[model samples]
Target: MGLLIDGEWSTQWYDTKSTGGKFKRSAAAFRNWVTQDGSAGPSGEGGFEAESGRYHLYVSLACPWAHRTLIFRKLKDLTDHIDVTVVDAKMPDEHGWTIPEGADPVNNAETMWQVYVAAKSDYTGRVTVPVLWDKKRNTIVSNESAEIIRMFNSAFNDITGNTDDYYPEELHDEINEVNERVYHTVNNGVYKSGFATTQEAYDEAVTELFDSLEWLEDKLGKQKYLAGDQLTEADWRLFTTLVRFDPVYHGHFKCNIKRIADYPNISRLVHELVAVPNVKDTIDMDHIKTHYYWSHTSINPHRIVPKGPLIEF
Candidate 1:
């Protein structure tokens, strides 16, 4: 919930006052790309050549954005090619994101912010996860989850031999269309509702949130997946949000219009994805619950984690 100001750590929560209680997320600062031949793919500086055992991932299991990279790593068989280090689930005020016991593995920095500062001495913005660090360069390649997953999707195909493309060329137009809608209305909508400081903001967010959810319900009912018969990036992108909706977001984040369990298609979609080979192994309920309830003191001041959701997935 906090960020770095000129590389100095500040415990300030997101400022929703200026936006009239709207919680607008900050754009990811590091946007370097990792290509097969180190050529620039879309944005940022190049030379991040894709190599086995050269890149490491930093993520929080609780974070949906970070969860995207974890799933892509498993699905694309980059689990061994790129090593990962999970941050401590607890977000104590004194320690924003720490490695409780193990070594930093990547840069040997104790906290996540230190890792960010390692990238840039005076970096400012939210200290987010799903950071793709290049050990060879000794700097962060990218912290943007979408791009990180794209790298994981194809960059290491030569080594992993798992050429399962989630973002296919033909469906790019439709998938991006669905992604834009889902990112605003659903993936980030729940946070907007909970973190909002104004009634108007919450109302607008919740309305869009459920509307998109219902649209998805109808979409899934008709088609096998969001983009089509093939399960593309669109489906996995929506999944991390739905998987946490009931267990945490429903009650914790005030996204209480309806649970995923209420929608048959979504629930089936969740269970189906969870049943995938390594996808289930990526889910850690304890980390998800602890991070939300324990952190975000503005939302849950008492810092008491709840029990008894009893989710099947």
Candidate 2:
């Protein structure tokens, strides 16, 4: 709902006017990766070694992007190795993500923007969550949820003694292919549909969203997971969005042409993922609903959080 301009917090809604009523998401400002041996993996500088007590994660339960990192943490058995600070679900317009005093034990800041300022005094951009902070360096290792989950997948394997590889080398091509489609169409498609200010933008986004959903349904019908028989990073990435479909994206985001329940394969995948140990515990429906309905005053002026549309998964 707000962003940081030169390290200063300013309350402003998404400017769809510039994009012809389309909601264009900004790229993550921090892109440093955490590797096992303090060496660079893909982007940014190195020296961020994966140590047991060297990193802290900041997340919001409501955010699907952040949810992906949480899922990876649970699946990769990095819960005990990496600590976390979850921001409040009610993101006030004045302050982006309310942390309150002492909520973030790592930074001890009241708002998320302050944490960004801590890393870089003149930082400018949207203050998003699932920030992987390196306590040893006292700077953010990575704010990109995709890269952060990758770090959790393998970086801390030696420390935790859990070598579950979600992004297997053999499945890289297939996983990337599925991720590209899901990221543009389904993962970010709901946001594009809900935040569109014009009919054209809404129609275009929703059309692609459902089309991809149908494609996913057909894909899952043949294979056990998105990539193949083994559950890979692609499945977890899409899991966050599919799990939130009925609860938040359906009515709240106006992605109601068809519910996830209507797609048997997709619905089965959602349930199967949630049934994974500790996976269901990562989800907080109240937080998810409150954040979307109460925060987006542009969508619902009254800020009345709906009580119905009971979801089973």
Candidate 3:
């Protein structure tokens, strides 16, 4: 809920009033890409070669965006190759995302914003997590989770020797189609509903969210995953949101029309995804709950994090 203005850290919240109560998320500023051959990726400059132990990831387990990158890191067998440092569960007023005692690793900076400053002296914008840090270059490879996951999906294939392409050439159209709908109505929809300043915005966001969930439920009833039978990136993308729905979004975000458990297909699909080795390890409900409730003072002024609704998955 804070941003850097001319490299100075300032505690600030989104001004939803300017957009008539709609929470408009700003586009990510860092658009660098990690290509297989150190060539220029889809955006940014080249020379970002894919090498083992060259990159380190900074993530908040609570963040679904960050969660995706962690999932890819494990699925791609890049755990030993790339290192990760997680922020503490609670984000205090003074330190936005600090490393608790004995938790500091990587750069051991006082705050996550410090990492941004380290990368770019005059960096400005929201200091978000899921930062892909390049140890070799001593800079960030990318802060945008979407692109970072893509990098994890295929960038270090030679090192890991895992060529499982989630974004296959033949399925690009299908994956893009699914990603577009899920990103708008489900992935970001929960945020829209939770951060909505107007009744109309909340209603619209909630409606689309449930509609997408229903569609997903029906789709899962027929197919095993989002993109046909094979498990693709779309399913994992949706899994991060679904895993958090019942535990956090249902009550915390006011997305309680129905829990994922109510939709048997989604519930089962979620459990299956969680069953994947190391996938469940990536989830930390403590961090997930603390980050959303404590961080968003606008939504929960009391800042009281919930404890009930024990989820089996």
Off by over 4 Å in 3: 101-104
Model 2 over residues 1-313: C-alpha lDDT tens digits? Answer: 7989988888977899999999999999999998989998899999998888889999999999999988888888888888899999988889989885677888998889999999999998999998999888899988999999988888888888889899999999999999999999999999999999999999999999999999999999999999999999999999999878888899989999999999999989999999999999999989999999998988988899989678887
> TM-scores, in order shown?
0.98, 0.98, 0.96
Candidate 3 per-residue C-alpha lDDT over 1-313 given as tens digits, one digit per residue, 9 for 90 to 100: 6888888998877888888888778888888889899999999999899988888898889889999999999999999998888888778765577766545466778688998999998998988888998887888889898899899889899889999898988888888899999999999999999889999999999999999999999998998888888888898999999888888899888999999889999888899999999999999888898888887776788999888679888
Q: Residue by residue across 9-86, what tens digits does model 1's lDDT show?
A: 988887888999999988888899999999987999889998999999998999999999999999999988999989
Among residues 3 or more apart in sequence or in different chains, the pairs in candidate 3 whose N, CA or C atoms overlap within 3 Å are: none
Q: Candidates sorted by TM-score, descending order?
A: 2, 1, 3
Name the TM-score of candidate 3: 0.96
The lowest-lDDT stretch of 10 consecutive residues in candidate 1 is: 94-103
- Residue 233, candidate 3: C-alpha displacement in angstroms: 0.7
Residue 279 CA displacement from its true place in model 3, Å = 0.8
Q: In candidate 2, which residue pairs get closer than 3 Å at backbone N, Cα or C atoms, i.e. clash?
A: none
Off by over 4 Å in 2: none
lDDT scores of the candidates, listed in order = 0.91, 0.92, 0.88
Q: How many Å off is the CA of 141 in candidate 2?
A: 0.8
Error of 2 at 17 (Å): 0.8
